[model samples]
Each structure stands twice: as structure tokens, then as C-alpha cells.
Target chain A: MVLVAIILSACAPGTPDEDSWRVDALRSIGDVSSSVSSVQLALQHHDRLFGPYLQTVAVQAEDAAGTASTKLSAVQPPEPYQGRSDTVTSALDDAESLLTDARIAVVRRDSAAYADLVRRLKRTGDRLSRIEDRIRALPDDRSRP
Target chain B: MKKLLNVALGVLTAIGGFVDIGDLVTNAQVGARFGLSLAWVTLLGVVGIIVFAEMSGRIAAVSGRATFDLVRERLGPAMGMANLLGSMGVTLLTYVAEIGGVALAFQLICGVDYLLLFPFVGALVWLVLWRAKFSVIENLFGLLGLALIVFVVALLKLGPDWSQLGHSAVSFQPPKPEAWSTWAYYAVALFGAAMTPYEVFFFSSGGVEEKWGVKDIGVMRTNVLLGFPLGGVLSVAIAACTYVVFNPLSASVDTLGQVGLPVAIALGKIGLAIALLGFVAATFGAACETGLSTGYSIAQYFGWQWGKFVRTDVAARFHLVLLLSTVIALGVLATGIDPVQVTEASVVFSALALPLTYFPILVVANDRDYMGEHVNGRVLNVLAMFFMVVLTVVALAAIPLMIWTRMGA
Candidate 1:
């Protein structure tokens, strides 16, 4: 009885006409939700398209390095390229793999695994972010321009 | 002299209570969405918090027991346990959300992803809980969180139309095209954010922690009366900033970065940086509060000694629960779930669970056995009863509204 009364009471009248603002706010919310959904989709694509290839590269890189110095030197490039190309490729591959795992988690709606994969992907993203930062920090003469 | 000190304590608790992650998001979200139409909710919440907080504080002062402690004694174990479970679950979820919030704020400022910051933020919270003196940890973050005043400065910089804002707040019709469900959902969300279970648990627990006796009743009263409303002002400032900035852009705040954007626009990077610091402090402070309250409720329920006043070795189980709660929160954040979404859900869940925690406190406050001479007078009872009715209604409507609005779309 009291519960019914409570429910009815909460049905109080709301704010008056501001239809335009309401549509605008709802649309804005929809756009943000769509953006988030899109990001999730992109992450899925990264995993499916690039994940296995990266794992193969990682294995090959491991095989190429019979010794510590050889492994380091093989991964390293010339003066112009430095060690960045290999690092960038490897990192991107790792990110794509993580994204793939994240996509699987998302499919399963596993909040825990989805969170973990997102964390892993974020780390990969951070590595990329740092590479960009370092590249930007370099003198203009070193740039393509 | 003691009277003055009590007033100061009230102010500090109110400050501590005002700026949880829910307030950070809800105030900003509503401000962005409806301008100040919902600003009145914050005021209403302040009044609600004050009324209930005073009652709980007075109950503690007179009975020499915190809110939950009396809840068990008065309501008996079964009902109290139900309240305990509901309140504790909501509080724990809130703790997880706040820890995530702090990490997200760090990500915003440092250009690091929030997950990377999760372990470190978790460790920092644990370190504070483990080592820092209770009063010091409480005062440090509670006081430092005042940096959130940057929001107020940003609001001033934005220069909103005050009369228009006042009209929106005073005019209570559901704005056009907004499904009544969505409006009510956000309304319930705002209400839940304002009267989160942790606030009462923390407030009542703080009263007990500070050793409030019957003589301390006046001090407790003043704290509830003044501090909460002041905190509401900060919430208003956040919402108003969003109203002025995001409303024009029609930007919905889905991230901590967006929440801080108005500050960034108004005061530039420096303001954004400080506001982020405030966000970190406020959320981290709340994390600690919820974490501690998790252990406090359990310990108090079973007749175990609890609180920061005791040493780690003496309160082994209490410390253990606190440690585990922080670990779980860290784990949740590491999963990379969006903290903002978690905070939204936490506030909604808190809204649904409101009556469980609050009704008991109201009942206890009016009990002659518990409150004695300090029992709620006629006026306080009337006000408390009214808000109780309000809270119960919001709780019931919260879930259906969420589903209907698709979590407010």
C-alpha cells in the first residue's frame, strides 16, 4: 500500500516546455553514445585485422634474436630509421592483438576481461603516444618537411 | 572554545562531503543539459543532507553510537543486515567508481591512460589508509579539494544569464521533447548523487570518530546545518559552468576531460590542471571514505573494534577489509570500464538503495531511547519525514525511469 503510494507520489509533474533544448540534449547524448560505440567497433577491427600478424612478427623477432646483442642489433635500424620502425610496428601489432582480445570480451559482455584488454590497449596507445611525443621533440631538420 | 572547534569540524566534514565523483559528474552533466533547472536539486539535496545529517549526528552524540550501530540495536539484526547489505554494496560500488575517477582525472592531465594510473592511485589510497594519521588524511584532501573552487571561477568567467538561470530553476515544468521518464531518471540520479548512502555513513561515522558526546550535539547540528549547503554551492558552480559552456555547444559530458573543459576554456591550461588536481583529490578522498566505511560497517556490525584511531595490528580484520576493498577497486579500474559510466550507475544504485539506509536513521533519531533530550524536535521530524517521503519516491522510480530512458539515452 505504502509502496503504491510512493510510486504515485514520485510521478509528480516535471519542468515546462523547452522542446528544442530537450531535443538538443538528447541528440547530444546520442552522439556521444554513438562515438563511444564507434570506438568500440574500431577497436574490434584493429584486433581482427592486425592481431595474428603481430603475434607472428613477435615470434619471428624472438627467433631472430638467438642472443641478446644479436636480438637488440637486429631490431635496431640505421641512423635515419633508428630502432623506432621495429618498435612502432611491434607496438602497433601488440595494440591490435589486445584490441582483438578486447573485442572478444565485448562480444561476451565480460566486464572484467573487457576492462583488462582496454587497459592493455591503453598501454599500447601510450607507447604510440610517447613515440609521437619524442618525434615531435626532435629538431625540425630531422622531419620529413 | 570547544564550541568553536565543533563548528570548524562541521565545516570540514561538509567540505569533505560535498565533492564526491557523483557530484562532480551530475552537477556538471545537469548544468550542461538543463542549465540551472536542476540547480535547485542541489539546494534541495543540501537541505536533505543537512536535515538527515543533523539527525544522525545528534543520534550519535546522544546515544554514543553511530547511525548503523543504532540501526542494528533498534531495527534488530535482520532489518539492519538488509540495510547493511544494501548500503555497503552501494558504498563499495561508489568506492570503485571514485578510484576510477581519480585515475581518469590523472589521465586527463598527464596524458597517461587511466588504467596506467589505476595501480598507482590504488597504492596511494592504500598508503594513506595504512600510514597517514586519520585526521591528517581527512584534513589534507578535504581541505585541498577546495581547489575545486576553480569551477566557481570558471563559472564567473563564463558569465551566465543569471535571471534566465533563476527562471529555469524556478520554473519546474518538464522541458519539451524530454520524455518524462528521462527527466525523472536524471531527477532521481541528481537526488541520489545528492543523498548518496556513503554521505550518511561517513557523516555518522565521522561523528563517532570525533567522539561526539551529548555535549557535542550543538556542534554536530551546526555542521549539518551550514557545511552541506556550502558544499551545494560548489555543486552549483560546477553545473553552472557546464550550463554556460557545454549548453551552447550541446556537448554532453561523457568523460572527465569534458567535465574540466569549461575550466580549461575559461582559465586556460593552468585552471584545467588545478581543476584536475581537485578532481583527483576529491575522488581519492571519497575512495578512502567509502573504503573505510566498508570496513567500519562490517566491524561495527559484528562488535569488532574499528576506525583509524586504532592501530593496524589491533584492528587486523578492519585493515584487512580496507586493503581488500582497495584491491577490488583497483581491479575494477584496470578493466578499463569508463569511470564516468560507473559513477552514473553508482549514483543510480545509491538512489535505489536510499530508503534502506535513511529510514532507519530517521527512526533512530526520533527514538527517545537513542536521542534522549537531543531527539528530533517537532520541526526536524517534519522536515526529515518529508525528505524521507521524497527519498522513497525517488528510489522506487529510479530503475523504471532508467530502463524507460535507456539510462537517459
Candidate 2:
């Protein structure tokens, strides 16, 4: 019975308070941003890396971004932070989508497509960094822990 | 000259065998996040492992018994059983991680799913353990594992601001945007990866396997003292490489593929190829060691007559343990769980298991019945005592910190 309860608790959606919810969203954005940057860097070095290696990294980045997106999306934000939460999730969705496209380019060994994908990845990655900075600058609301 | 050559081989193997899957992943993760700030923990762990490894090696050489054997005899059955369970659980988890790591390394080369590669990697490791000679397993993989030195070359080639890296190495502070809890969590992980309990078990048992008598003590000390520190350097180089390429971009490293990116950027295709080879050799070699260790710990505890020096038919139960462990590891990896996550959990749990593993070695190393005149000297005793306290504290804090930091998130 105890084990079942523990498992259920773990599997249940996390309805974190506003402060902690923002923190989770921020972490998700940072993770996806980092993964996007990694894919971008790998794509830039396409000629220097083995095709399989490049494809593996791209797939890994896509998985990372996808996982981050899913995790943040699962969290139930406090009422006041719903709009902000949507913004974070939307940005994460964008990052994950871009990473999926990058993984495809890598698997297809579409070098010509990489230059364009690289541009989009950089823009998404920069947007993530900016979101991360904005979130980090938010005032602490430690009262709601 | 042959004696010198033996010492040289021992040292090189030590350096090559030092960075297993745990070290590679943890060091890279910590590096990409904190730069070299947590490097002191690795150094501390190296010294700690060196201290205990030297003790365990001496015990095996003088007593002609492995760690588990002495542990059972000296600590009594109940305590020994406790130690065995704790250490064995961690070693087995590490075995699973290493097998998964080997599969992941192959995945990078062939772009095959690591889950699809688990059985093949597990079978290959078991085949080596069953058929290969002990020295063959140790030397070939250890030498090939040297390819990881590419990380050091990559670090140098990246031409990082040495002074900045050196400052971070000494500062012991987490870079901003990271919590101290996370920093402490990775510190424990890094320490656990460095001084994994299995290294000592494998070292002492290998001593017994190699028939290290009193005469071989000098050579054993050379290997532990010289090789382990250099291996620790390879670990630091890995971290520095990630720091140079990933940290400034605020990029986190969560995959083996990201771990190799710095090398590709630094030295291009050739360097990345060598790095991949290093990953395969290191993880494969560690898989063999951890697999054998699972067998060694069980057989040593039960008095079942184990060692690679003996034929598999002669050590039937021991070989059986090895086979079962491989299957079990493969079974765990088959869950489609991420190997990197398994590696992370294993290292943290390794920290939690360290006290149970090392306390027995310390006790037996000081026992006059086991060591005779070869007992630990005054200076060595003080150092060992210090590490015992540190290991105990690390073990106590491991679970709580792991929970608090959410596996270093």
C-alpha cells in the first residue's frame, strides 16, 4: 500500500507553487537551450565529425529538448503564473521542434540544409538564453514554498 | 630491466584504467557546469583511493587473500554480510552502467540505438571474462583506453585561459546560476566516481590473481601511487574540455555525444575517432572489471574458490556469478532507460556505499594477524583515518543530497 502511494505520488503531476514552478520552467529552458547549442555546434562541424557521430548527437539533443518540454508541460503552475508558464512551454516547444528538424537534417546527411537549420537553432538557442536571463532576474517569492 | 618494465606496465595500466564510465560522465557533467571548481574533490578522492588501495593491495599481497575474504574474516559474518551487500549492490549497479556505457559508445559509432546494442555488448564482455587471460584483459584495454588522453590534447588545443581554469580549480565555488546544493551534489558524485569501491576490490583481487607476494609490494605501491594520480589528470582534462566548449555557452552536457563534441571541435575527425575508441576501451575494460568484481565479491565471501587464474570449470560458481551478472545488467539496460542516468545514479550510490566497503580494509590493514610486520605505518595510518571520516560523512550525505538536488538536476 505504501509503495503504491509512493509510486502514485511520484507519477502524479507536480503542482508546484509559483516560485518553484518558475524555477522548474527555467531549468527546462536552460536544458533545451544547451542541447540546441550542442546540435548547432555539431552541425557547424559536420565536415569535421563522422556522419554517425553527428546523427547520434542530433538525436540526443532532440531527445533532451523533447524530454525537457514534456517535463515542463506536466507541471501545473499557480494561477498567477499561467500565462508565464505558457510562454515557457511555447519556447520549449519551439526549441524541441527545431531540434527535431536538426536531427532530420543530420540523419539525412543534408549538409545543404544544415546552414539554414544552424541559423534557426542559433535563434532559438539565443531566445532560450534570453528567457533564462529574464526568469533568473525575477524576484524571489520564498513565502510560498 | 624486466622489473622496471613490469612497474611501467603497471603504472600505464593504472593511468589507462582509471577513468571508467562513471568518471567520464561525471567529470564531463561537472566540467560543463562548474568548470574545474570541483576538481579538488577528484584529487581528494584520488588520494583517498590511493590510501585505501595501497592498504587493500598490501593486505592481499601479505595475507594472500582478497578484500572480501579479509572483510568476512576480520569483521565477522553479520558485519561482513552487511558490507558485502552494500558494496555488491553498488558494484552491480556500476556493472550495469558500464555495460550500458559500452553500448552507448557503440551507438555513437554506428548510430544504432544503445538499447539495441546492450545484448551484444553484454555478450562480448562476458566472452572476454570467460575466455581471455587476466593479463590480456588488463593490458589490452588499459593501453587502448589511453586514447582518452585525447581529452587532454583537446583541452590544450582549445587553448583555454589556463589562469582562469586554475583559478576556478582553486576557488571551489560554483559558477553563478547554480545552487550550492547542486554543487555539493556533483562534488559527491565526482568523489564517488573517483574512488569507486570496485576499483579497490578489483585492485586487491587482481593482486591476489597476479600472485603478488611481499616482493611485489614495491611494484604495487608504484602502480597505486603513480598511476592513479595521472589517471585523475585525465579526469580533470575531460572536465576542462567541456568547460571550454560548453560552459560559456551555458550548454549542459547530458549525453555521451556531447561529451565527445569538444574533442571533435578541437582536433576534428581524427581526435573524435580516438576519443570514441577511448570510450569503447575504457567502458569495455571497466565492464570486465566490474563483472569480474561481482563474481569475486560473491565467491570471496562464500569461500567458493575464485580468480581468473583458475579455469572457469574449476571456479564454476564464480563463473556462474559472472554470467548471471551480465544477464542481469543487460536486463536492466533493456528497460530503455537512459544509460547516462544510470551512470549518474550509480556514482551517487557508489558514494553511499563507500564507508561499508573501505572500513573493513582499514581494519584489516592494521591487524597484525593479517599484515604481520607489513602493517600500516604511522603516517599512513593517520591518512587512512582521515579518509575514513571523510568517507563516512560522504556516505551519510549522499542520499539526502541526491534527493535535495534532484540528482544534480
Candidate 1 per-residue lDDT over residues A22-136, each given as its tens digit: 3322233233222232233233333332232222222222221222123222332335543444554454445445444554554454555544554554455455555544443
Evaluate model 1: give its lDDT. 0.70
Q: Top DockQ: which candidate number?
A: 2
Can you give the lDDT of residue B137 in candidate 1? 61
Q: Write model 2 residue lDDT over B73-142, tens digit each, in one string.
A: 8889999999999899999999999999999999999999898899999999999999999999888999
Span of ten consecutive residues with least summed lDDT in model 2 chain B: B400-409
Where model 1 places Cα greater than 4 Å from the true spot, the runs are A1-29, A32-145, B1-6
Please state the error at residue A21 of candidate 1 in Å: 22
lDDT of 2 at A81: 70
Off by over 4 Å in 2: A1-14, A139-145
TM-score of chain B of each: 0.96, 0.99
